[model samples]
Target chain A: MTLPLLQVRDLKVHFQVRAGGIFFANYLPLKAVDGLSFDLAAGETLGIVGESGCGKSTLGRAILQLLPATSGSVAWLGKDLTALDRAELKAHRRHMQIVFQDPLASLDPRMTAGDIIAEPLRNYETGLSSAAIKARVREMMEQVGLLPSMVNRYPHEFSGGQCQRIGIARAMILKPKLVVCDEPVSALDVSIRAQVINLLMDFQRALNISMLFISHDLSVVRHISRRVMVLYLGKVMELADRDAIYGAPRHPYTQALISAVPIPDPEKERAKPRVLVAGDLPSPLDPPSGCVFRTRCPKATNICALTVPVLESAGVGHEVACHHWRD
Target chain B: MSASVLDLKNLSVRFATPEGEVAAVSELSLSVGKGECLGIVGESGSGKSQTFLAAMGLLARNGRAVGEAIFGGINLAAADENTLNRLRGNKLAMIFQDPMTSLTPHMKVGHQLTEVLVRHRNLKFPAARDRAIAMLRRVQISEPERRFEMYPHELSGGLRQRVMIAMALMCGPELIIADEPTTALDVTVQAQILDLIRRAKEELGTAVILITHDLGVVAGMADRVGVMYAGRIVELGEVHQIFNAPQHPYTKGLLACTPRLDDATASALVTIPGQPPDLQQLPTGCAYHPRCGNVMERCRAAAPPLMSTGGGGLKACFLENFGSVQAGTVVP
Candidate 1:
């Protein structure tokens, strides 16, 4: 097997809920991401599927070391990011970058689009002067389909889709080996979403970069990703190639997620019985005792609740955490 | 044949924007039966929402609407504010896509529901409160009694939408105009909401005109479907025919664009390849001609009238033989 470009093992992130000052000090932890493990091979796109509070975003942030991880390892290009100090981490930042969900929020209002993209290069590459940075910024802007003349425009002047292209240009300017795109296209219009997604795919092909693409949109993930991992309440439920995940989802939760995607065809929609799971997702801070999906799983037996099911190999390269795969 | 619950003939809606006078909906003709759901599907600026919004007499103050809106013998187009105000929440109720905007934030859910009952149904506070709780329960909202005191902020998006439905249906109106009711919801919850609407419409025997851009939602919810484009009803027919045998090029384009899970036999979706037309300057002939694959010289200059296509379908395309096909049956 080819060596993975990014390796993550036992990654955990917990927010400290400080309490009790008068009598006895007590600390409660909100385990947003706990013991999560995944890997992204060279030039491969790994899609993360989960709902809003499922810690998928937290895992992304933890991998990038944007948020401090409580424990575990994030090995990128033979370097363990967990042990890196502040200065060392800063030095290693150029190879890995992220694109946030809301493009408007990520960019600065005061800075022009050209300056925004150049800021990363300027801060990291101090040897390069202003003139060289401008040339590089112009090249990156055109690559992402933004007009070079509009480089002087601010974030507010551009539409949601354009702002996202600017965001992509900023992320890709560093020439990162791996990009963590967290719901980058969710905020865009449906028509514009396709354009941005196609652009990203094109850029990825040209750069030969690996991406940990985290999004709730299964269709978008299916279109671009090589592999997909299903997360539920801070735990992995299923992980497989994109085709298997979208085509033949093994886990019950994965099945539910895919089935829930609104198929635009009226006839096919009418033909299929919608497998809508009842109730909201279980809180990550206080997840269920055993299989995370047992609470909502239709075929869940008492065994599912009593014992946690580890990822068992279902077929070639398909792993699912369902307690009862057969009868 | 059954009398139409709501019918609009040659309906047109325009807004005076900073740019120009834009016709959001133009020459649109459609109807709803006594208990039927007519799903209007289209993209943004297709005027799907605006068409229904005009029919409900709920367009913003600046909007200009013309043509005929004959609803159970009353002409809504020429109706005064007092007439519209009287008929709005009681006679014709509309539920929007976003419940947060439709619902008042500071007010308790119960109080809002009760206000509708008290004002339209003419019930007193205690009786209204009792009915509101019953309405909440009817929509399958959990703990209706205690939930009554909670504000809009306290409820989830799905729950708040349920509350909105309860309020919309509280008056027990003849026509319930729901505009993209499930667009803001998750897929699983979207199915659940559709089920709720389906059940409530049946129980109450209310006619619904569900306007949505999601064809999947329309497929599950609608009895009949109307395809809109650039502010006009380009195609209208029974749901089965519209899905199985789409005739218009624009309609075919829409059908092809959808991504389905079970549909592994996927073809490259033929997207319309451009933004929805600028309503201010709608194309001379078919608004869809620019993006249409089967464009002809005749399609570029002459606007196709909304004429009936035989077998209970209506289409507006220069390419379709409308007059000879449906004979002489008018839409409404």
Candidate 2:
């Protein structure tokens, strides 16, 4: 079998947050990304979806080695990224890049559009002349639908959508094998969102770059992703092909999450049955004992709290972590 | 329609900015009937929120509102602070997008709820407290008694929103202007909040004006929707008509731009080229003419007025028979 482009095994990211008053402060381990395992093909999009505190962003950062993992490994083409030191990881940074959520905030106000996009090239290809780098930057700007003439304009001068194009141009300039998009279009207006998403899709198709697209917007995820993974309380609840996850989500949390998304068609939205899970997500500091989602899972029972449910195959290319998935 | 609870006639809101005079909302006219939800859908800077903010007498210091917002036989736009204050929390209430910011961080959540009743309804402290707790329970915040004493920060985002809803329902206001009430909430939590709003409308028969950028939210919650662009209501129609057959070019482009859950195909999303209009220096004639796919010479010279679509809705477009026109053929 051909090796997957990226392999993540039992990856975990835990933060030690200080709790209580200053005099009686104690550290609590916040399990942000807990034992997540997945694989990305050479040119495919794996969408990570969950609510605000579900740690989808943490998983994306952990896989990219931007955040330190507490345990397990992330292998890129058979090389373990977690095992690498700062110097070693620096060498591998050229292979991976991230597109952040807040486009304006992600970009430096002092940097011009051309310099921002050209920074990656300057860092990676030290031999390239300044003129050559400028040419490449302008070309990438044009490719991303930004006018090549606006290369010298500062980040603040551009609109939200244009700033995002600059950010995408920077990420794509490296020609990275994998791009991690963390809510890339959430900040954009509805009309502008489609534009940014299309740009990313176009880049992915042309360059054959693998993507770890993390977003809370299920509809956007469904549009761009080949496979979707549902996360709840820092654990994978269900992972399957986009069709299986959206069409026939087995996990109770997945079902509720999918049902909660309001369809644009008024008639269909009104007719659709909603499976709303009760209560908010439990604190990551002290998650539920066994299945993390058991506290809010509709199908949760005594057994769910007694024993942790491992990811089990339900069908071809579909895996769900639920005690009563079949039901 | 049922007895009009709030009728706005040519309401225009302008803000005095350092750059120049910014027209936030211009020549907008709409009404909300009893027990009806009139959704105002628009992107940021489209002036959906400002229209209601002006009616509520909540515009910023430099902002000025003209025209009439007739409610309870009073022109709210021209009403003084005393008249507006008396009506604001008693007959009218607002639930903002961010619960944390809208709520008083320093005060107990329960106190905030009771204060509304005590001040607006002339309910005494003990009676107001009882009503506040009951209101909390109605919004489905578990252990209402325990949650009452807690500050807004102690509660989760969903729970805080419930508290905000509970506060809004304290005096049972006739008209509740919910400005993106569930925008900051998670999808699952948003469902719960929206359900609460739906119940409030259905059970209490209170009129609601839901202002949001999300079409999906409007689809589920709103009975009638008004699609706004460049400080104007470009399309006003029943929810079914708006979504099923949008008449305005901007509204159509917006509906097409939104990624639907059911459409999982690999087709490229139809983008409305260019960005949202700048409020300060909006394009002359039709503000949307620059980005609109169906732009014509007439559209460039003269802005279209709100005209009847002959389908129980109004659309601001010069195009004749927009529904029958083919996609690419309209430009000529």
Candidate 3:
């Protein structure tokens, strides 16, 4: 049997946050990502959707080994990535890459767009001549729909959407096998956001690249991902195929979140009954015990607070981590 | 029919940047009826925000406005500083995207709200305090009395935004301009804030100008919608007409590009090719022709005027059958 392209198990990321008053300073572990496990096929897309403090971004970084995981196993092509040394991981870094949310901030201001795209090529392949690198950069820029003549322009000269295209070129110049897109289109304008989304989809199909897409927008995530995972307070609330997750979500939090999204159709918006979850999301620093989502879950019982529900399959290809999830 | 609460004619705003003079808004005209909500939707730098900012006399230092904004028998665009100071916040109120920046950090929420009432209504301290607390309770802020003493930083984001809304409505303004009021909020909190704004319109009968990029929010709140592109109103109509039968190609393309929640298994999202036009160096004729799918030879040579569709709407396009219900093709 063939191995999955990437496999993660029991992934946990914690940060030591300062707690208590100044006079009695003590450290508390902020469980950013308590436990997450998933697998990515060779050319599949897995989208992670959640709100601000849900740790979606942290999970993406942990997968790339950019941040050390407190405890987990990241198996890439049957090799354990978490156990690899610094030099060994550096050699494998070419196969993994990341695209940040803010295009201008992630890019170096001093370097021209062409130089920035070519920097990865030069760093990975030392034997390549300068002329070859320049040719490759120009080719990649053209593929991403950027004018080859505008390569010499600085990041400051381009608009937000154009800067995002340049960011895509930089990430794809090496032709990596996996790309972690962290809110790639959130910072762009509405019209320009569509352009970037289409461009990313085209690249994924043409190159057969696997992406771990992380975003807060549900519609955008559903548009690109084959499977989706909903996160709340750094725990997986539900995981299933895109259609299953959107059409028939099991967890109450997922139901409320999906209903909270205002649809563009006026007639339907007026007719549909809205499920509004009350109160703000509790701080991750002091997450509620047992089921982390119990504080906001409408169907919470006494048992929900007494026991932590484990992620289990509710139906074929659908897994929900709630004790009171009734189909 | 009653006269419009506010009328704008031939409004233009220009900014002097290092590159050159950029026309942020050009000869735009709009109006808000009594107890109506007008939503202005556009991408970044499309001048949706600048149009209202000019009417409110809130343009930046390097920006200049030339227009006639008749509000309550007075030209707000031509009003003096003293007149504007008296009218602003008393008759005309504005809500910003970030509530924290608008509210003073050092002052208590109660004091900030009371200052508006004291200055506008000439109310005593005790009376103004009572009014401020009442407004807070009206906006559905729980523990209104206790929250009244809390500083701006002490409140959560949703509470801070509610406080901002309460502060804006303290003097019972006739017109309130909310610019992306819910953009910085989460989905659930965004719903709550929109509900508050709707209640304000229904109960208080105040006209509102809502500026945002989210079509979903516009569909829920706006009675009328205006689509802007390259510093011009490409299309304007009732919210139902704009959503069901968009006229301008730019408006249609924008609708198609957005991923709709109702589209359960949509395989691909439509996209408008090419970049948004730069205001400083906009192409001649129809500004959207370069990226428009239904572009023709005439569109590249001559500009199209805002022609009335005679259905309580307007469209600026060369196509004769612009407002047809069928979706237009997207030219690559």
Measured against the native two-chain assembly using Cα atoms, what DockQ does each of the candidate structures obtain, in the order listed?
0.30, 0.73, 0.64
Q: Which ten residues in a row have the lowest lDDT in candidate 3 chain A?
A: A270-279
- Residues B1-332 of candidate 3: C-alpha lDDT, one tens digit per residue: 45688898998999999998999999988888988999999998899999888889999999998988888888998898889989889888999999999999999999999998888899998999988898999998888999999999988888999998998888888999999999998887888888889989999998999999999999989999999988889899999988887877888888888887778764556777777888888999999888876778999998898988667899888788764523333424
Highest TM-score scorer: 2
Candidate 3: deviation at residue B156, Å? Answer: 2.0
- Chain B TM-score, candidate 3? 0.96
Candidate 2, residue A96: lDDT: 94
Per-residue lDDT of candidate 1, residues A82-145 (tens digit): 8999999998899888999998999999999999999899888889988999999999998887
Residue B174 deviation, candidate 2, in Å?
Answer: 1.2
TM-scores of the candidates, chain A only: 0.95, 0.98, 0.98
lDDT for each residue of candidate 2 in A1-327, tens digit (9 for 90 to 100): 999999999999999999876888899999898899999999999999999989999998998888999999999999999998999999999989999999999999999999999999988899999889988988899899889999889999999999999999999998999999999999999989998888899899999999999999999999999999999888999999999998898998888988999999999899999787798978888888989988988888999999999999999999999999999
The lDDT per prediction is 0.81, 0.91, 0.88
Interface RMSD of 3: 1.5
Residue B256 accuracy (lDDT) in model 3: 86
DockQ (0 to 1) for model 1: 0.30
